[model samples]
Target: MTQVIRAYVGSLLGFLLLDALWLGFIAKDNYTQAMEGLMRDKVHIWPWIVFYTLYCMAMVYLVIRPQFNAEKASGVFIGGGVLGAAAYGAYNMTNYALLADWPLGISLQDWVWGAVVTSLSSYCGWRLARR
Candidate 1:
């Protein structure tokens, strides 16, 4: 139980840190704008992001690598990322369904980016576990 709790916290912290690292490095290091963006309703699914991600990861970990600990967290992250991408795709679809506007190839792009980052985060956690 302690281990699972530890795993959850460890994974969450690592995920947040990694998210910040990339957001800072490439997204012009702008939090104010991000805050503003999250505060809106058009793309205002901000509250769902954290819990949804961790939950997806947890599902992935429990299913795929129950023994890998930190490494398992990576799988969870990738799982969660895939979930996130699907969500964005779904959100766009629902909004533009009437207009018939789809993201087409952009969904692929999000998938790639999300997978890469999530994998990196999971890998970092796995390596940190050193077992």
Candidate 2:
């Protein structure tokens, strides 16, 4: 139970930090240009909180726990990337398909970001849990 909590906290922190960097600095221009008229001036806080909570829980359960149990960092990295890519791809691809103005470049960039972030976070979580 303690290990699970440690891994969850570690992964959540890692995810938040990396996502902040991506949204605030790295991909800000891309997202702004892509979302232009589609974005709200102010994002609602509750939905995002819910999303992060659920997403992190899924990551901890599906990626971090297995890697911790197996004591294999590679499992965490690979599984996390795959899971993240699939999850993000579902959202992005669906938007691209349904929304006329959804940018393909944005979707691609987000997919990459999601996979990389998930892999790194999962590794961090696994390492923290092992300690």
Candidate 3:
């Protein structure tokens, strides 16, 4: 139980920090240009709150816990990256299929970013759980 909590906390913090840096600074202009009219003028807070909460839980439970117990450090990073790819791919592909002008480049970039971010975040979770 305690380990679960630690993993969740660590994963959430790492994910949020890395994502914030990417969205708020690194790729802000790119995303703004890519999303353009699709984006809301004002940020919606609730959806993000819910997404982060549930996503962190899933990351900790599905990726971190099993890998941590198995003592496979590599598994956590690999599994997390795969999970991120699948999740982000689903969302991006869906948008590409449904939306009129979704940018393939942005989707590709997001897929890579998701994998990298989730891999590192999973490492953070595993480290905390192991302690």
Candidate that scores best on lDDT: 3
lDDT of 3 by residue, 1-131 (tens): 99999999999999999999999999999999998988988889999899989988989988998886776689998989998998888988898889998999899999899888988898898899899
Instruction: Please list the residue runs of candidate 3 whose C-alpha ends up more than 4 Å from where it truly belongs after superposition.
Output: none
- Candidate 1, run of 10 with poorest lDDT: 28-37
Task: State which candidate, 1 or 2, has the greater lDDT.
Answer: 2
Rank order (by lDDT, best first): 3, 2, 1
Candidate 1, residue 99: lDDT: 43
CA lDDT of 78 in candidate 1?
A: 61
Each candidate structure's TM-score, on Cα atoms with residue i matched to residue i, is 0.48, 0.96, 0.96
RMSD of each: 6.0, 1.0, 1.0
Model 1 RMSD vs true structure: 6.0
Report clashes for each candidate as comma-separated counts: 2, 0, 0
Which ten residues in a row are the worst by lDDT in model 2? Answer: 65-74
In candidate 3, how many Å is residue 105 off?
0.9
